[model samples]
Target: MRVGKKLFPYPVLNNSKNNSGFGDSNYQLMITITQNENYFIIEKAYVEVENQDIERMLADGRAKAIMVVECSATVFREKYEIGIEPKDISIPIGNLNDKVEISSFIYANQDIEHFNSNDFLEDFADFDFSIEKYDILAVDDGYTTKVVFDEDKDKKMSSIFSVIKSNNKDLNVMTVSSENKQIVIEMPSQYFDYHDNMKHNDNFQNIFFAIIAIPALTQCLQEIKECFSDVYSMDINEVMNDKTWFVSIANRYQAVFGTELTSDEFIDCNTYEVAQKLLNCGSTKAIEDFYNLLWNGRSDSDDE
Candidate 1:
């Protein structure tokens, strides 16, 4: 609505019944301005259903100004639904009870989409706005996954680009590495047991791989095996064999590789290195070895 030299915007009031007869504008935009210290604030911007008591609310010392907008049948919720801009404005007032809510009730509950916030600002309130759309970047993987957002995702070493890598449970398998940006992958190898309760088609840990995150770096399967083999040289006593899983890996290396690799050799190595060997050792053999180790470890502990 246009006042002497100012224009105020309001919600697209739908289905309002015009009562005051001024072009049947049909709705009212009620604004209560309050003062805190030296500045003025839009304490509340409400949609009043009726315009009967306008003079009484504004005539008081505390109330600043009120406007009536003609939209449809829409009204602001009673609990002061919308947020005001400028946080606090420059309208100084003498009303001590200016903070007290005048317009108590409104019509409906509306979201941010339904209302334009600029309308509530006082004439001097300066506001600026712009819109942003994200650009897409394609990885080597043929975009089977839906892209929620793909901008500035260089894993870590970037000041401009920012990407959110969430644990995407919608995928069959989740591939987490030591890196912050992990992938929801569906390869033949499964490294993480994060989805153990869920059923998946590719749960096989069939290849030895390291979860190294240098952009576009692929797995060096042979290097992983050498790390595991090098670990075989470690003394049996220094190895961390407190866990039950180590016994199985030691037993499995002896059974499948036909080499007397003790738990000290296997458990003493880094986790990724051991994971690589477990992957290259074939999923079937690794699972069988795990169970056998689990059982054999129990038997040995009981014997002692």
Candidate 2:
């Protein structure tokens, strides 16, 4: 995405040497995304350029603005002109995955010889400079937002539990470590090998979630609850400042439920509620998927 810079020879709106004559002029572009059904909806896509000169240029058809959106994961790239095209667009979820970056820019649609704005700097007020086509007059880096579908969320259990393999033959079947931010669950070689091998299989993944992730998360939440038992006076953020996993889950909780819990609520909430918020009902989803996978497999075998 193009960012406003000092590449232009003349005093552009964003240039450091831009004259104050274009008083109180600013450029802002905002783009936000939301998900609905099978589409990623662009909730907002608008540019607010507070400059009369630029507005006049746009009105006179000298300048054109466009918003560009790209999602590398799905190899989707599209652009919409500010006034000429629809701003709020919907992209099929099939055409999107992971991070979506949006950027907007205003540029000269056609070359203009001896272009000079009335608000040019004092030294160059009377001077004129040739403007070339596609010369960026203004730009906003815009913003990036993530799109996580149900399938994607189901596969993101690793964020809450950092499961690793333990090579020591004498170690317990599983060990939980919270010394670092993430709650690391170390499993002996045999169990870890089984998990690692079948992690990609949808049915096996559902089974692992039902067996391993649920129990590990339950324990992790219990430890957090106990850690703050005596410090109910302090904020949860302060108490778990070092535990990034807690922060991750808290943010996810808010994203899923559209509300943040008070520190007291975090401490007082039951383990089941905490689990639901943290996992976005992932446990129930896993159970359903597991049943479906088993039932579908049996039916296929019976048909054969």
How well is each residue in 1-304 modelled by candidate 2, as lDDT tens digits? 5453435566566522242333346666766677886898886677777777677788899998888888776788898787533368778887776567778777898997887766665766888878889987766667766654456453344665778999899997788777545678899999888888887665555456656766677787777778777665666655444565665677666776688866766777787656744654556666666677777761111110
Count of backbone collisions in candidate 2: 0
Give the winner by lDDT: 2
lDDT scores in order: 0.29, 0.68
**Poorly placed runs, candidate 1 (over 4 Å):** 1-234, 237-240, 262-277, 280-304
Q: Report the C-alpha lDDT of model 1 over 238-263, residue by residue, as the tens digit.
A: 22222222333444446555778754
Candidate 2 structure lDDT: 0.68
TM-score of 1: 0.19
Report the error of model 1 at residue 298, Å: 38
Clashing pairs in 2: none
Provide TM-scores for the models: 0.19, 0.54
